[model samples]
Target: MSIKEKIMSDLKDAMKAKKTDELRVLRSLKAKILEKEISERKGGEASISDEQVIEVLMKAAKQRKESIDQFEQGGRDDLVDNEKQELAIIESYLPEMMDDDEIRSEVQKQIEQMGASSMADMGKVMGVMMSKLKGKAEGGDVSRIVKEELSK
Candidate 1:
């Protein structure tokens, strides 16, 4: 099943199970999709591709992560907990994230393939790496690690 169908199926299951938190998160995702679709329609309509949906999901996950960090910093434990739960729900629809080792190895591979040497070569390497690792790795994380590796 496509990601969209999988999400819809899970939403129905969450509803049947009375998983209020899960249902709420899923509804928010649906709303995000609808909002994107409506915005695109105002431009004369466009089909929502799976890639666009995945991008929305990724954005939601990133937002939750930031919110969690801010909540913790502000000492709002309850808000942090809710953001964590929402993040968990958002992650369920995303592709499995790469571990440190995997991301490092992938970054190294791209760096080598692109013949990157000094830090100045970062843009070239990053451009290729981002496309290859899209949705699989966080861009900021990859950039940080790449800079460290290249500076060596």
Candidate 2:
């Protein structure tokens, strides 16, 4: 099943199982997906694709992570715990992200493929790498690895 369909199915299951926290997260995700679909249609597009759904999920996950970070920095353990729970739920649907080693290796390969050397080519390397690693790796990690590799 598509990601959207899978989420919907899980939502129903969560509801049936009386998983209040999981149900709340699933409902919010469903609403976000529907909102994205409506916005796409209004833009003269047909509907949001699976890729778009992933994109939305990633954004939500990122937001939750940011909130967790800020909450922790502010010593708000209560809020941090809540954001962590939400982030865990959001991550249940995202594709497995590459670890640091994988990200570094991938960045090295891209740099070699592009024949990039020095910081001047950072833009060229980043543009292609971001598209190649989209949804699979975080942008910050990719950039850091690229910079480390190129500075060699």
Give the number of the best model, judged by TM-score. Answer: 2
- Model 1 C-alpha lDDT per residue in residues 1-152, reported as the tens digit of each score: 87777788999999999999999999989889878778778558675777778888999999999999999999999999999999998998898889878999998888888888999999988888889888888999899989998999
TM-score of candidate 2 to 2 decimals: 0.93
Off by over 4 Å in 2: 42-45
Q: Give the count of colliding residue pairs in each prediction.
A: 0, 0
Whole-structure CA lDDT of model 1: 0.89
What are the root-mean-square deviations of the candidates from the true structure over C-alphas?
1.8, 1.5
**Candidate 1: regions farther than 4 A off:** 39-45
Reference-based lDDT, each prediction: 0.89, 0.90
lDDT of 2 by residue, 19-57 (tens): 999999999999999988887885576667888999999
